[model samples]
Target: SLPAAAIHRGAPGPSVPESPGAAAAAGSLFRPLSAEDGEQRPAEIESLCMNCFRNGVTRLLLTRIPFFKEIIVSSFACDSCSWSNTEIQSAGRIQEQGVRYTLAITSRQDMNREVVKTDCATARIPELDFEIPAFTQKGVLTTIEGIIDRAVAGLEQDQPIRRVTDEEVASKIDEFIGKLKQLKEVHSPFTFIIDDPSGNSFVENPHAPQKDDALVVTHYRRTPQQAAMLGLEVMGSCCSVVSPLHVLQFNTNCPECNAPANTNMKLVQIPHFKEVIIMATNCDSCGHRTNEVKSGGAIEPQGTRITLQITDPSDMTRDILKSETCSVEIPELEFELGMGALGGKFTTLEGLLKDIRDLVERNPFTLGDSSTPGKTEKLQEFIGKLNEIIEGKTKAHFIMDDPAGNSYLQNVYAPEEDPELKVERYERTFEQNEDLGLNDMKTEGYESEGASGR
Candidate 1:
């Protein structure tokens, strides 16, 4: 199945509260139900069932206590309507080496209608399981031999009385059946279901009858193992195929679990937005983290910009690169703030503006030196003074990388600084890399030959 890459590509409507005059008048749409009243059941109804069995000793246990009756209830609501229909059963008065049972059925209509019941006083509820074939289309069982052959294939080879593999295969068949269920075909409204009557088929584990009327209906009163196999068939198949809604519950195969787990990846495609963060990652155990980066000037959809940033030469390249690369991908653009990059190469305002205008003609953005006349030389003097305070001289060491990947320098610093006030000193550290690409070199703080060649 395709991932939800373009789910949010469209613009959304604005949110505003409606006036009180637009509110609807309060009133009940349907009549409320009373304990004694009976009415027509809704199109769909929720149903519940209970069954019980007892041994000789269990019968004796039941006779001694007035309220020691065992009761079990399983409930389900209809898909089309919220009506609740229930089937209740009780193990009646017990006789030595004999069993008695009673069933009470009712729908949401308050009508105490008993749909079906059988008092199996002589028949002992036995454990059983069975398997049946499923088809994508309704009324496809034209040949009896073919249906029997499929049912046989669903059965276990070793155990003839109980089914095993057939259940799993049947599920695969159900996957295709579900797709048909959505179609406007004759079988579209049907669902595959397991129909268990006695509820004693699987010892502690019971098999409930499925309500799907899409395929050929065959009742197999076998052992619980047989019924279990039948269940496996429908489950395996229906689960394999999914709709848009069901995909959310589906898990991707995660290597750690050897099972499918959902992914955090999302696709964003929009022209105006250069980048968008589809998802974020953080180390739950530790504070270390990273983010995704978009390259090739790709903009995210819906004009959403992500965490990716363009590199500026003037900023601390080490910090920026380390922060950006620590997570997923590197950003596309870079900015230079050193001696000669963008419009910042010239010291004068007019010269800087001219450089900027030229840059605007080629690119949409640029950076330039912002120093004014009074502070032009003062800034230089401040750098020198800081160097002397830290190193006891006007000069300090420096290291830089070349923009063209052709040159590099280490341990070079200013040779002059003010020799007066105490200077706060801090060490600079560079990141270690085995192989630095052209983009990586830019972060190493290197200038091009045009600016530093002299």
Candidate 2:
């Protein structure tokens, strides 16, 4: 197979026949023709077909200006293929917005998978016209080189991976489309493979999950320059081994049998981890092969690895000790998990420790048989004495109004010095009228003196 372009209709192709060592690739074109031949056209021209020959009726003219270095046509056929006996208009350049592009019409398709047609005048974009004689003489190799040279000029580049999702694949396709669309002004035709079967198909372990098995790959057409960059892989029966290109550090050990068990022990990192295994088996007795596998997990002696290690004990001073506060520390306990009604065994270890600490701190007082359990006789005697003192202090400040009116009335007329004599007389009077009681021992003559402040 020249390429999938030979099988898929409308796929873009580039053929270069002019360059050194490229002439051998000339026959790769779809159907070669010359201007001297009689005008001829394919018998089955489908809907959009136009004449491949016009003046003398010869080869189909695909492109002009000789930019495409290679050309290969598909044997694949579809209803869209067509031919017209009438000669088509000459292809020309078109300017849209500010961009310029060479326009050509062919029953052929461009690299972007857009069909080249002339019947639909309403189409916003123009088409390139073609004639047979112009195409065959230019040579495909020269055309391909020219197309590549111009397309890659000043273009940006990126690396992309294609995954299993439809959206991912569509995005990659769209990128190529955009590049081609931008180059429409260059006017030269170019070809690239899209959806090539062998190029696009991926293989992976079938037992792996579908999503995990998915992989992204990069591919390119074989070129001498690319062949030099091919990667090499070495493998054992069970696994593939790869070596690193650079080393971070190295260690010195016994040249042969680099094992810790050996008297002379040193650790080193080779550019590749796999090299360590080989170093380990450097000197082995043929009769007994030491199948020890060197692990890649060995640390490299660099930065933190090379720091001084403290081995000797240092004298401690009181100043070095941290100031501390009293705190309780408990030992962590492990117990065999017991089966329970619930799915898993559970215990409130933290809560239980807290309750135990509370119990120890409380130290509740214990009672003796000499006192009543609820009410202690000694406590009652202490409380009664305290209550009696409080009541006596509360009654000391009280005052009472006189119940005998005559004594109060006579006191107003009597001199302050005669207060004792007046009280003595009031007592005698009250005694004489014991049957009348203190209320009847009143005096009417003292009213005027009491009112006049006498």
The TM-score of candidate 2 is 0.14
lDDT of each: 0.23, 0.24
- Candidate 2 lDDT tens digits, 60-163: 23222111111322232323333312222213221100111222322122322221222111112222211222122211211222333323432322223333
Tens-place lDDT digits, model 1, residues 234-327: 2233443222222123233332112223434333332321222232234332232323322322211111111212122221121111111111
Candidate 1 wrong stretches, greater than 4 Å: 1-263, 269-271, 274-279, 296-454
Best by lDDT: 2
Residue-pair clashes, model 2:
36
TM-scores for every predicted model: 0.12, 0.14
- 10: Cα error in model 2, Å: 15
Q: Distance (Å) between predicted and true CA of 241, model 1? A: 19
What lDDT score goes with residue 25 in model 1?
25
